[model samples]
Target chain A: MSPKGPAPSSVVREFIKDIVVDNRFCFSFPAETSALNKSVASFGVINPVWIVKSQDNRKTIVSGFRRYNAARKAGLETIPALTFKAGREYDLFIAHVAENTAVRKLNVGEISRVIFCANEHFGHGFEKISDRLFDALGLERSRKIYDMLLAVAGYGPAAKDIVSAGMSLKAAYRLARFEPDQRETLCKWIMDNRYGTSKSSLMIDMIDDIQAVKKKSVDEIIADAEAHVSPDMEKPQRSSRLFESVATMRNPILARMRRDFQTALESLNLPPSVEVIPPNNFEGRHIEFVIRARDRSSAISSFKALSKVAEAESENTESSKLSGLFGWI
Target chain B: MSFPGFSKILIAEEAVSTPLTKKAKAAWPDIAPQIVRNLADHELQLDMEPDPVAAGKRTLALGPNRGKFIRKCPGTMGLVCCNYWVIDLVEGCPIDCSYCILQGYLTDRRIRLATNINDLVDEIDAELAGGTQPVRVGTGELSDSLILDPQLGLAETLIDIFRTRPRATLELKTKTANIDSLLNLEPADNIVIGWSVNTPAIISSDERGASNLHDRLAAARQIVKHGWKVAFHFDPLVLHDRWEEGYRRVVDDIFSVAPPEKVAWISLGAFRFHPSLKQVIRDRFPMSDILNSEFVLCPDNKMRYVKPERLKLFRTLKNAIVAKAPSTPLYLCMEGIEIWESVFGGSPRGDKNLCQVFG
Candidate 1:
């Protein structure tokens, strides 16, 4: 539709006609269109239809495969669209993105494509591209771009299936922080039923370890990563059932220090978390201490005493390392 | 807008009207109520509180410099005002921006609405009264310049104050539609009215309680229509989803409202936060995805985008801004020397400042 043409109102809906996907401006489905159609039927089209005017003047769908399929499934001949004057395929792709992602939802892949194409097309960084898009969209959509980037990094590609395909902004941001290779791997892993969202963070941590130690050998990186994995994130190796019978004595060093702090409190018997240890590990960070008490006054008193002890310990520990270590001992 | 979490207040018994003040009242009335309420809310203990200004202070000092001290703004070669001079004004803003550093740095969480305008003027007058070189200054370093315009009429008074001294110019940076206090003022080539802007998301999530981006652009248009030199800022440019579209919209919107020739200058700053304030901001804006960007520590220990990332953002923003405001002076805030060299291709200077381009 040309800018000079009349805008689509409720009445214009009747005049709107169905168009095919064989136009010069159209692109193919990245995945299964039928499945996408099913998803859209069950969920809904998250992003709008990207269309371009065919030589014959029919508005042809350029993007939004799911939307097109859903429309087909619904036996609809036409869909809502604002046609673009297409030139460069990349530019058209970006325009398609700006049209929908501005106010609607997009997957990390779609967002990354636009950002990547923006740099490739306009020759700029994600920040400038983001700002430029922000200014163009009037700021609201620009904020979504920031969130999308975080999603891609945090969730990786599996996020595309679990989050982006469904258009969950929160999940996208959580996935964006992971390395691209890891994202793809985890995505496949999730697809193959090896892991789920519950194990997502653990997978991401393993990826982070690999990335951190990339300069070392792959074996070294994996070993280091394996050593650091909390028992929760990694499956413990079973020694033919011999290791299962050994009486386990698990003692958190920090918990021991915390117990000492509680003993010092005496009648102050504070909550397990409130007793502050010396600032050996958690220095310069505000800690959340829950002081469960019989009453508010005792809680208050325990808080005061804990604060005093923490403050004194922090100072003493800073001045003398030996005392700091010994204090904990 | 009501300044939430405000505990301390200072009342200004004196009613002063300058052109800038009148303009501000006409621009944003929401700000006036908060400013006026703050003045009435606090106890007037004395004629003046101690100026807690300190020499060689860090960048994260909250408002209320305990002592009156003079320090140069570490502004680079070509920018207008020194950033440090403005830091001495007030801390804590009532306006919320998801990207605002105050979200992280300001512990008090209340608007430290500074009422010691007289003392500030006196100190500025004494310092720059006979200084040999021209001194560039602004009030937006700590708080929104016109947030208190209705009650204090600060811009008008400051414009009038600066009229006597041609060497110094006061730039009031804001994201509000507060131009009334500035419209009627005798247009001073020296006094620059700047508006901080970003993608719509920046305004919505980062700049909560502030005017929408369109309103700000409209306000800038009003200023230019009234024959005042204007400026725009994309400071704390956040990396967000569809950021390209967002920034493009901002640039196009600005051009539609005010011609490039009407602009004095434009600034581009990538999102940078103090280490201490990151958690605060995260807690305050739990849904904000800004904290998840690829960040590296600067020499100041503040978290900023990597140099490559900064350069990339700078280049993209600069190219688009220059398309319309080609001749308008552009600079970066709190960026390093290498970035300046890489992005703009040359160092910026005072003669190269916005005043030189549009003054």
Candidate 2:
């Protein structure tokens, strides 16, 4: 292909079967096609997909793979596409990535694909291309991010899907450090439970602690009855319970402290209007007393009641016990 | 130090024509200096890179120490703080330790070498004159005191200032063997030169660009030969396989080089960092096994080894040091009173006792 103007007006109508969906260009976990199909059916593809002709006289969709799939599903016989002269492979990859990124923010899986595809086409000198590629793709220009995205791309398609769903880039990078089967099981569990980004991160830490400290296999840890998901609970409830159980098992001392705090609070047996709140993680010296009093008189009465309760509790409880409850130990 | 050293030197315009800036320019005569309007301009130039670590390595910024140069060490709340005073002459360190808290503590990576040494000296003199109680003052809290000492010669100036003061001691702490500038100076009873030492394995693996364990001990030996009190900090002590043997070797190396009475104090602190430093470590040093160990978030919001693990490491190391030099005072840095009591059978409780140990 000879050099031409930068922006070529080469829109053409091509048969649906003639356009190929390159796996490199398509998102691993695409959005639902029905909505796009409905839109294309009603509005008739407003924007033409970008494409490049191959040596075999076939066209490859550089961008808009989702739109092509949606158009095909909508029973359209043909679609509009703007073909660019196939220049250097690097340029083609950049154009494809730029078009897709311009359309919407790329997810973790798509970002991984772009990085790997760029590397394959550009032939390894990441130091030269990382800054430019990151800038063009609207990614943080960091070697750390580049390395992580590459590792995330190394995962199988299923794991990539899980990452695209909601798992954070950091969590995916951490999971990539594990063995393939372990990584898959962990990712699948996270996906099945619909764990949000933060929960997924916590889950990863829990698994890491279990493997490192307890010397248990990821499979064994997940298969334990303590981690078993209750059938009657909703997804959020199941995830919350599983997270709590994992945290409790991971830090038994902390769990014991929390349990002791609860026991201490219950032993006080304060009225509902007067509540005692322990510090976060029971790691502070002060316990807050929150009293819901209606007026000044009520406030005075609540304070008097609190004083009485404190005196009685002090008389009953040893200083060491109270100090331990307050994290003085 | 791995990267190219300081491609461009940026001097604050406000600091132009000052003696410190002139000294900085003279220190590196080969590299022409560029005078920016202010430190803000220098920072703006640094912000151009998306990731500034590399750029920061190649750029050097010299500015006045606008903030209070002499301030209390912001020790973690609820922990037994040893009321140490800090003299921050620099903002960042050149030697990169994988587990360094400065990686997260500093906002930028540029080596902000403060050229306003006169103001720092004035502040310290004022602080010492105001109080009769002896105070332990150090310059290694923000950056290593001697990494750039060959160029700036701040150590000599600081030593000269502290030698005359009766109520304060100047502690020059470092991980490098950059003590050539201070070897020939007059020995001050109040001046203590401290070295941050770790196991040989950790020195090779994590402490990039720092002097190795052998060289640091040799440097301490040189300082002690001059009748200057020396201290050692086994800070951020990492636990690895055969760690006991590794740490035992370090303790033995310390006693072999420096005499027991000449040693001022030995401080032990296990690896601890803010929670955010965990990700930074993983990103920067992927192969480091430091984070793989068990860590719990303490009340101060820093991640540390759990109580039992910390107690075990401290007690073992303490016993080793005591066996070698029973008279040398040992203290724990930034540790809770409970751990202190567990390890030492009592707590320092306040700064007065801690200062008295050194006194």
Candidate 3:
């Protein structure tokens, strides 16, 4: 129940160098041992690091990675430890999960490792993963989510850094579908540019569409998409521009229809208060106009303006122009 | 093997003495049938197979129909109903489509056949016993009607049953071309042979183990010549580059072989699936590009094309089909009034020709 993990018999000081950073059972983010280093330098290890005797008689650190790292950094000759005889690979790995999940929240990268290890332990899939495992990690019990975690767990180092650096798990999952180098390029595009979760997701969907339609590698698609974006634009505008570029590449015809419709509407140049709402997917037969009027006279003026646009008889009239929108649908 | 290409014969103990099991044993004298007392408890430990679903697919199981085999199609909520009926003659399809709903929800994943044809026929008779109205019953909802029909001669047996009841129309829908059994039999107006169709591009990319577009059309041509009323289902009209051209060509191909008059009906449905099937397609068929589309969740809680795109796709295909054959009793499957009106200018509920079946 304690953050330090369940107490085992016979805590003793073991040489810091003797504790190997056993990645086989590790579930921690990159070391953040600065404060711990200063603390250990002053106070020494207040808690014992958990280790198991490896098959070859070497001591493997199962938990307390941060404390171990800090002790090594603080130039300690030895640190207090709890030792156990290794029973099973999965059991030892689960002990690592329990120790860290008890003390702090695991980042997406660390959680990926947990899920990856669990899936390996299961020897098939995590389809039968326990609700307790998900609950213990403060996650929604979903195969889809766990599948994403398992995928990210196998991701290249660059993606791991991005996941650890705080990319939303959903965005990372989408990006993970691509090949490693392609994923690295997209990771740079997303993380280096600091695209938020929503933007990152939209951008990835657009890229996915382009890749699917063109049947090109994702790297080529990203390269082509990024070429259309401007370096001079501000961040949000740049993001919007990149999205539009990729979206256009995804569906050029649909995108052109929408753009042409926007131009035609702008040509009407209705008052700022009068807004024309395009049909939803141009589905069904409906177009709408909104007139936010302060007075009845302004409302009348807005209607009169709509009437001019709607009631024109000439083939070249604005009404006829609006008819083109219907044709697109 | 009753069903060829199956690696294992999992038999329900209840089906041990059934005609189907006898046919299976007589066909394959070598493989032993694993008789399961409760199929629910029977599990396939196919861990070594990289894809358990694909491996499970290669396993066949014959079982008693646990529930009613004949039922009205549970069409999604808010979708137009054609009043079509379905008989679960088989429990799973051998032809794998990336968008198949089976990938998401079929609990018993192996290809399972209903061993009690007599009970199945009895259930069908009870449904159509008193009905003077023509009823359209099909055998492709849960499984392709003809995937295993070649080995079992399921078509000949079911057609024999329906031929006696002139009012009960039986349709066997499939993606396979194994119609040799049905060819020599007397063709009845009540018995229609339907085929799920798509563009050749789609067939090559997504439909694994199914007949190619050309072969399917050829099979349809032969069936029509044999005097059976044939139907076509462009159920998953997928959107891709040059999709219009692809669909137009297939439409031309359809009219060329199966003439408009001989065709009983043609149904158009966009590629729709449960959202979770996306992962299955990605895992099983990574080369599949069908998931790369703009999809929106609909009222039925299935992912379909966006309304505008859907309307556009339907209108384009409808126009092409109408140009070739204006009176083919065209209808939209699992679609609601809004789309029907948007594309056809009225709902199927109002069309007199379609109303006879759906009214």
Structure candidate 2, residue pairs in collision? none
Q: Measured with DockQ on alpha carbons, how good is candidate 2?
A: 0.18
Give the per-residue lDDT digits (tens) of candidate 3, residues B1-359: 33447777888988899888888766656778898897766654343345657776877888888799889987766677888888887877777888888876777778778788899877877888766888889988988888887677888989999999988778899898889988899899789999999999999999988999989999999999999999999989999869999999999999999888898888999988886676678778888888887766655667778777888889999999999889878999877777888899998866777875553
Question: Number of the top candidate by TM-score?
Answer: 3
Q: Candidate 2 chain A: worst 10 consecutive residues by lDDT?
A: A320-329
Which 10 consecutive positions of candidate 1 chain A have the poorest summed lDDT?
A240-249
The lDDT leader among the candidates is 3
What TM-score is obtained by chain A of candidate 2?
0.86
lDDT of 2 by residue, A116-180 (tens): 87776466546655755787777665666777788888897557777776666876677775788
Reference-based lDDT, residue B143, model 2: 83
Whole-model lDDT values for every prediction: 0.56, 0.77, 0.78
Looking at model 2 chain B, report the run of 10 residues with the lowest lDDT sum.
B44-53
- lDDT (Cα, tens digit) per residue for candidate 3, span A1-329: 45433335499888877777766656677766577878988998898888887689798887788888888878889988888776655555656676678888788888888787677744536544544367678776655577678889988876786777666787667767787888777767766567666666667666765676677877787678679987788887776777677778876656766787788777766677788776544433456777899999988988888777665635466546666545544
What digit string (tens of lDDT, one per residue) describes model 1 on residues A124-229?
6646666555444333333345545434534443555654344334444544545566556555544443344544433433343234323333234434433444
Measured over the true interface residues after superposition, the C-alpha RMSD of each candidate is 18.6, 4.5, 5.5
- Name the Cα RMSD for model 1: 21.8
Q: Residue B22 in candidate 3 has what lDDT?
A: 89
Q: Per-residue lDDT for B298 in model 2?
A: 78
For candidate 3, the per-residue lDDT at B8 reads: 75
